[model samples]
Target: MGIKKEIEIRCHPLMSWDISNPILSLKSRTKEDLKLLSELSKQNNWEVDFAKELAMSYQTLVLTDLQQTILWVNAGFQTMTGYTADYALGKKPTFLQGEKTSEKVKSRIREKLSKGRRVSETITNYKKNGLAYDCLITIIPLLDSNQVITHYLALEREAA
Candidate 1:
């Protein structure tokens, strides 16, 4: 089989992405993006050849720097949280926390972060409308080639 045939056989329907007009170009992507792309490609059977676009297409993806400053948020995040990327950028994830949010959960998350560990917590998060809802947040650490933590990929979903 040829290279084209190999790709055709390996590519899953969900992995199909238009490379013609990618959201973020491969050349312009940051080191973190490259690292994430490589990681995602290796872990999943799906062809993540267009990892940049796949990341953008994620329903609840929120990329943040090591300092926890928002770097990029996907459209799904905007629709779910009611905050545009422009408004969310450079802000901490704590911005979503409100009076109804759990203090114990916040402290646990902080502690886990200080230890540079992945955290999965279900807590109350308020939307822009001030309506509180339970959200399952999973923060994954993005590491560089040398294993230095560079960024975080926070996946959020409404808890049933």
Candidate 2:
């Protein structure tokens, strides 16, 4: 019998140089922008509204459970990942994590998430192009009644 062949797919990587965070580029207090994100998160159509206001050119990722189900994504997500909303929705954000990701860093994230607190850390992520980029990830634990973590919200920016 002939040998069978198998195929695998992967997330593509983004290639560029020296791009600062858009919030940092505004030349004003980024604290305000950061604060606004908190306020907007309470809104119903937060994903669409915030992406339009912030001019996000990449996907805005949100996880609705510790298992990392994608809860919300904006148009930028489609543009960056070359995947439509239907394909990306409900998928795990770890789709971005790969062989290049550091186990130590991932361990740290797991530790923090398990504690039910906001965690900020930078780690490597492979984009849809299979190119590597350093993503500054800020993960927030969303709490429900009685302060139980109902979800995790993640924001990412390219490293300076």
Candidate 3:
């Protein structure tokens, strides 16, 4: 399949953005306009109810760094682990990896991540209360413009 094509749009004031004058090229915009574009891309429809869609099911986590910091966690994390996002953030993700966690498994992950390769596996994790559960994991490295690895992106689901 071919790659998707992105449509380019020039956002401007209603007065200057005349549909009838399609042939006219718009003047360059200021840095402020670029910032506006960036903000628009990141905006979400806060009016939409996400909890309703989730129906109080499912868990999600965003893991990062070698320390495995819990950069972000959703409501599901609270439902599953009984820990709030406030408590999870800035802490090592391995807090969930308990005594039974295999050092071999952790080392395998370390090797792959150090080379900036993606890895998928099913491993054991613990809840705040010390209850253990299996989790299917996907780890992705977020790279900067220079292609250097920065943060790790981890998607986790209950192991079936």
Q: What is the alpha-carbon RMSD of candidate 2 to the true structure? A: 11.4
lDDT of 2 at 66: 60
TM-score for each candidate, following the candidate numbering:
0.65, 0.60, 0.60
Pairs with steric clashes in candidate 3: 68-93
lDDT of each structure? 0.63, 0.55, 0.54
Whole-model alpha-carbon lDDT for candidate 1: 0.63
Best by lDDT: 1
Per-residue lDDT of 1-160 in model 3, one digit per residue for the tens? Answer: 1100110122223234433443341112223233432332234211222223223222454545556665555334555565666676778777788888888888898889878787877778898787898877777665555566655656567766
lDDT digits (tens) for residues 47-151 of candidate 2: 323434344322344434567776554333444455554565567877877898999999999898887766788888777778777877777676644566656
RMSD (CA, Å), each prediction: 11.5, 11.4, 16.4
Stretches off by above 4 angstroms in model 2 are: 1-59, 79-83
> Candidate 3, 39: how far from true, in Å?
7.3
> How well does candidate 3 score on lDDT at residue 116?
77
Give the poorly placed runs of model 1, Cα more than 4 Å off.
1-58
